[model samples]
Target: PEIKSWIDTVLYDSACDSQPLKDKFRDQLGIALEASLNPRRKKTVTENLPKGMKKLTAYGNLVCNA
Candidate 1:
């Protein structure tokens, strides 16, 4: 459960079973927890459409720019 907590809060501190400076990778990249390496989001997928349409919208109707 600790690992899950770390991931949920965007927390990471070094690596497990790894030397402090064996590869000096923390600065180059970043601390990667096992939980973050594998995250799964559960949600439903929906394709909104008109009452009777055989084509998909080319772009979203809610003007993103304005």
Candidate 2:
């Protein structure tokens, strides 16, 4: 029967090696998935830094803390 033949074909294809398909999928989506899963936050700069002597102390503290 045509239905039986189709089922057999489906089973045969499903049993065949699928590594190439998996590799292609990974190659296409790996970077995007990795970025989505482990996103990097951009470091923002302080726009309103202390103007004078406090600036040096602030900078020193920032550097030391980091």
Candidate 3:
């Protein structure tokens, strides 16, 4: 819980905040943000498609940039 709160504070912190605190939170915050921004879901295969398609499904994140 404390770590989550700390992450929130760091994420919302302004540029006016002291440099040391920013540095302290940088690594952990980066990990949290990356994990959250890139999300993955389970994909399923169905028989409705055309023949000769590979049936194996891979579980992975599908990242999209707009």
Q: Which has the greatest lDDT?
A: 3
Q: What overall lDDT, based on C-alpha atoms, would model 3 receive against the true structure?
A: 0.42
- In model 2, the runs with Cα more than 4 Å from the true position are 1-17, 31-66
Instruction: Give the runs in model 3 whose Cα sits over 4 Å from its true position.
Output: 1-16, 31-66
User: Of models 1 and 2, which has the larger TM-score?
Assistant: 2
Provide the lDDT at 62 for model 2: 38
Q: Model 1: how far is 39 from its true place, Å?
A: 22
Taking the tens digit of each residue's C-alpha lDDT, what string does model 2 give over 7-66? 321211333446665455456544211112111233433556544322223223332222
Against the hidden reference, what TM-scores do the models get? Answer: 0.16, 0.21, 0.22
Q: Which ranking of candidates, highest TM-score first? A: 3, 2, 1
Q: What overall lDDT goes with each candidate model?
A: 0.36, 0.34, 0.42
Comparison by TM-score, 1 against 3, better one:
3
Measured by TM-score, how close is model 1 to the native structure? 0.16
Backbone clash pairs in model 2 (N, Cα, C under 3 Å; residues 3+ apart or in different chains), count: 0
RMSD of each predicted structure = 12.6, 16.9, 12.0
Please give the range of 10 consecutive residues that has the lowest summed lDDT in model 2: 31-40
Query: Which stretches in model 1 have alpha-carbon errors above 4 Å?
Result: 1-16, 21-23, 33-66
lDDT, candidate 3, 1-66, per-residue tens: 356653553233233445555565565453222122112344545445455554434444233222
